[model samples]
Target: GLSSCFHRSEGFMRGYPRVRGFYEVLSSCFHRSESPEGLEVYLHALQLLTTIHHGIQTLAVAGGTGQALWTFLCEVVCEDLCQPDDPPFVLQEQKGLLVHALAVLSVLYACQNQEAEHSEADTLLPLVGSMLRVLQYHREVSSGHGQKEKKEEEEEEKVDEQLQALIQTTVEFLSDIITHLTKDAVCELVTRGYLTEKTCLSAVGSLLPQFSPAVQHLVFMLSEADPQLADTVRKEFPVSLSPS
Candidate 1:
């Protein structure tokens, strides 16, 4: 059981003072190891992090305890999880860790946005970049997989769906961030290659209905970045000089 496992693991139980630690000695072994052994420590930490994230998400859904999880997520993002160096692992393990971390952070931000009265765009922007980097890496791996199984239509569809979801979430987050940034920042976002034509179209289609004229103009500028996309937009959204 999870309770038993938690009780047996000191590092996992450290955050829970009420519980007696059973694995304290084994946990000390982690701290005693050298920097290279930190990878093993991180593997354990990731396990605990996964449990905490899921437990908090569940509590949030039940209206029990979400803030604790949110705080933990912030700490993990700032301190532990976003390491500069990738671990030396098999491809599968590396991919699994990346996907798990990205999924947890994505849910955390989405929940925070939904629960808060105002937007937390600043806090979320960097997260969007991080998630994009992970997704881009995943997409590259997936493209290779797709080529390897080019004739397998079902497998290709599964890969496409995963890629599409990543793209959609990225566009949504970027759109939200753009809404809070200056026009210059928004322009820089496009010029820096962070906002592509597909993302721009997605952002416009999703944000235009709710944003102000200024935001609409920014979206217009983004859409106009690509003439082909601009022409498509004009055709799809024909303007009328006269009032309806």
Candidate 2:
């Protein structure tokens, strides 16, 4: 329904006023439908809204709309999209929605972070946790059960285009967040029970040789923020990561 609606309204997202309703519509649809395919349409449309300067500016609405949107999207990503009980194969099944949600959230998270720094801790841990979880699943499915390939092109052939984009976006966003962690921020994540050995292991599994530099940097940060956590991560893969 929305796919057709979006196609019919060719220039609906031109002005700021026209784009403001998109978030409200997305929130309403997700609550009503709760279907993966339906949510995909909403996230895709929402992603498009963030592509323009005018739309992004409108999305940066202060206490009125943008704040609500930022909060809603965090829940959408961390809780609604993929659940802990779901298996790794779900990542492949929901590639399109994952790509759309993550891409748009990255944009909105940046906007919200700039708008108000207070909620960073509130949202950052769960948001990064979800991104890492998705990435770990991507790695699990993409590996094709011990069918690893050395050549980049050969590896590329195993995953479809949408999934390739999902993996790339996940790594990029995770890197942006991980590489900039303050010692205090890392401490907060640890104290709040978000940064633990299991989380570190997932981080290692996804990052490893693909994101060696980032993993290495994260290790350095952890060493300063909390040595026990850093040691746990380091022991998991001693050879793969060296201090930066």
Candidate 3:
């Protein structure tokens, strides 16, 4: 029954032979008359993706299946439903999808074997950038700051907590992946602007308390690659502060 459901639905349209079908479904979800129903169907597909991710270790060894699922999920989230004028869903449902999708991708990246030696940067980096953009858009829409004043104290604190948690999970996952990657790959990610100052700060603040010494050192190296991030750290963590 599960296999039949996946076969009949758009979820099966992920790999090379069915990618066009996958894109068509996504495009239809974006612009068809049955957009809301399409969205629900897409959500169902994502749930199936979660199941596939959970079975990766046992059923799929090379990680290609997981990567394909990740790529499709990213396309649906970042490309289709993530547009400016997209219809609203229940907020909690939307957040659940975003969080789960992100968490699953993190797991896939972390679980790759050492002998694989493949670069997932092409797949993972865009997902991270898109997630950041979604978070930024949500913050903007909810807080109404419009690039003028700094976010209000209450608003900033709330968003900072949510964003920090997401960034922490992502960074922890990436830190694990970084340990397995070549130094040149790590340096390339830094130099190519994939790891921005804001991302570095948020990740460092959240991850420093959890990761081991070696991971922390890697994070520090990545953080130091951005001069603006160093200045931010100095300002936020100044020495000799007066007692409150």
The models' CA-based lDDT, in order, is 0.43, 0.71, 0.50
Could you give candidate 2's per-residue lDDT for residues 130-214 as a string of tens digits? 7777776776666574233344786456656777788788877787677667778778777866677766677676666777777
The numbered model that scores best in lDDT is 2
Clash pairs of candidate 2?
none
Measured against the true structure, the TM-scores of the candidates, in listed sequence, are 0.38, 0.74, 0.52
Off by over 4 Å in 1: 1-93, 114-122, 143-188, 191-193, 196-221, 224-244
Name the better of 1 and 3 by lDDT: 3
Better of 1 and 2 by lDDT: 2
Best by TM-score: 2
Listed per model in order, the count of residue pairs whose N, CA or C atoms clash below 3 Å is 0, 0, 0
Q: For residues 57-130, what per-residue lDDT tens digits would candidate 1 score against the true structure?
A: 44345232333334444344433433324322222333333333344444544555443612343444345434
Q: State how far residue 45 of model 2 sits from its true place (Å).
A: 1.4
Question: How much is the lDDT of residue 66 in candidate 2?
Answer: 64
Model 3 Cα lDDT, one tens digit per residue, 9-67: 44453432332354356556746644555655554454454455334352234555555
The 10 consecutive residues of candidate 1 with the worst lDDT sum are 17-26
